[model samples]
Target: MSDFTTTRRSFAKGIGGTITLAALGSTASAQTAETWTTAETPTGNTLYDVERTANGVYAVGAGGIVLHRTDTGWERVLDGGPTGNGNSLYGADVTDDGERLWFVGASGAIGEMDVVSQSVDDHSAPDDVTNNFNDVAVTGVAGSANAYVAGDSGKVYYSFDDGATGTWDYTTPGSGSAVNAVDFYDARSGHIVDGNKSVFATDDGGTYDKIGLADANANFYAVDSDGADDVWIAGGGGMIHHWDGAQWTPADTGDASLRDIEVAGDDGLAVGGGGVVYGRDSDGWNRQSTPTGQNLKGVVRGGVDVAVGAGGTVIER
Candidate 1:
């Protein structure tokens, strides 16, 4: 196991509150134009993941909490989560068409939310396996996309039938090390990082081949893949690794471990411990200031940038 596995596992388990804020000034000259403001959340539960859809932005966290951001502000859409079982949701992703949102969580909890109807369909415990899921990725349209779920048991569960129970199947990509994050740039192509400090790539959705980062000392937590040539991974020791088809380059932002990252075209954002936010511009990745001191766990980058974390904390750029 990597040196940071125990620390990250504790953080993932110790996973609070709401407050609105004004634009904060940046201490770094590189991020003078970048400022983030906090949003008022309805619950104090720790949010694990956030994703943006056509309807708006949604964040999920402890006690099965799900919050939605509208034109006016944030609102609680589901209090007891997808199954009303109060499971802690850890990961979420929206479909390619932005019509549905898929979330995975503790106790094998899995759900799909319809953006237009605001209704959730529970798809938990597929194959009778009740292990906790860390993250998820969906490819294609809302109802027809393939779903890939990262498991704590070092397995990647996939469904081609929109998460239908019997359609679920899994493949082990690592040597029994927990798979932390998974992302797909296309229907059958994606990447995954695990606690063993290993990176794997799959083009056919099941079989995986070991990639680079073999000497990494930190456990990778999140990954953003744009293609076979464009991939970014965030993990312990404030490390960021990028794979451009040939080799993996590493960068250290600070001491705080990054939990999530998103890239849209040339612009990108990564969030992690101590409310640290990193912005990628034409030059390179630069740390940005945020309004909260709590650790950030998830981020979504696009027309509007938003991050959620430790508390019910929500911040936008």
Candidate 2:
């Protein structure tokens, strides 16, 4: 195996409790008061991913916990869904219209939720291909019918039927590094980032090409795309990298390990261990104040920005 693949596997195995040690408490003194406000959660489960839905925001976490935010506030939903299995959900995505929601998690679990009908369909990896799915992405306005899930051992699965009635086809890029996240900039172009400091891009859905990175030790956790040529990746050691169509450039975020990222237009936010939140703009990345000191795991932007993490923490901006 390549050094990159081996290093990533070792890092993943030793990441437990790292987030707690990385959090230096809230840096509220350096941030403005208008930046973030704490929201209540029904459980103390560690939330792993958040996404903007048609009606509001949804966050998924440990213990089968799923929370939805509407005008009223955040409420726990999907209690009877796959979350009840207690598998830790790691990533989520929604259709452009917010009518369909897809989430992937531990033990090869994949879930699809119908927003309007309040129903869920769940699937598991084939016995021969069992691996923990870390992230999921949906492409096109056609909804969740066409989706991708990235996971351990460099596994990537594609489904053309919303994962409701058909089997998903699987592929493995060359690295064999654990894939942390995936995003599609268009119907035919997508990107996946792995723990091995590698990025893979695909334009035709059948093949993925590894994109070179300057730092081979940087562990990327999440990825987002604003357009066909603009992409952002965030991860270990406060590392943030941008892809501007031709090349990847590192954007500094101090020393924190960013776990999730969301971008809308030129605006973007990355959240990570120790409640660290960084905002991006024309001036580049800047740290933002958050109300909690808990380790943040996921962030999403919509009518409002919401972040979720350890201690069932939830905050909005």
Candidate 3:
């Protein structure tokens, strides 16, 4: 492990309420805009993963429902929406090619939706390998077609041919189970968290090796790689791990179950249960306050903009 140390700091946004985050993003431009609102058809449903594009903001949740937001307002894409099905969406992937819009959720629901055509068709996986995928990651390379989906039960599936089909390769890297999140730098090198505790990395993409960190039993939920060597992972009890080209070491953000995290440019944001938002910079960790108490499931960024997750809980930073 690299001998890097992590430091935690606190901040007060002076807006609505105070949130305690270990480290918060300071290098990125903080949002002075307000983009928080309750979803329509308020059936008391929860929003899982949220994504924004040049068009608008889209969030889907329980009950086979989809919600879209434009400059106008939020609207239900389904006729009656969340209409029954009781299915929960875990994650979404917007193709970087500006070609496809895909969504994945619990119960192996994957689709390629036609934006201009207003149609969505199922994307299939192998029989014995379908999973309640927690997240879908599009290979962030130009003209790349691979998208990987991860979830419970030590499951990890990917498609170099773009979620069409692939060899069923499975592995349990540790004693604690479930691969909650996965990210790839090229197609060959990446890392995944074992129930937010331990991390496993693969230099060859087809095979894997474990990098023992300073903390054990750290339940890490999410992982992201800026390059083959530059990677970050976040998880349970608020443990943050960064691979600084040499080794995987723990970056101190305290412990608090940081469920989801996003890194934009040099800045990053970590969100988790309890309306929590942690911002990171060269100095590391500051809390952003908002008038929310819902548990944030995920955080992502587009441009200098940021979006957070909670049940029907969406905030722009």
Off by over 4 Å in 3: 1-43, 78-86, 115-118, 128-130, 140-144, 165-176, 247-249, 303-306
In candidate 2, what are the lDDT values of residues 113-225, reduced to their tens digit? Answer: 77666577776664445588888877644344577889787888887666644566778865688988887755546778887887777876547877645544568888776
Candidate that scores best on TM-score: 1
lDDT of 3 by residue, 143-231 (tens): 35566666566766666665554443545555636777766554455666676466666654455566644445566777766654456
Candidate 2 error regions (>4 Å): 1-33, 80-84, 126-128, 141-144, 164-166
Stretches of candidate 1 off by over 4 Å are 1-29
Question: TM-score: which is higher, 2 or 3?
Answer: 2
Give residue 144's lDDT in candidate 3 (0 to 100). 50
Error of 3 at 178 (Å): 0.7
Per-residue alpha-carbon lDDT of candidate 1 for residues 49-124, written as tens digits (9 for 90 to 100) = 8887878888889988889998889998887767788889999988887888889999998999997788999999
RMSD of each: 9.2, 8.4, 8.9
Candidate 1 clashing pairs, residues 3+ apart or interchain: 16-44, 16-45, 16-46, 17-44
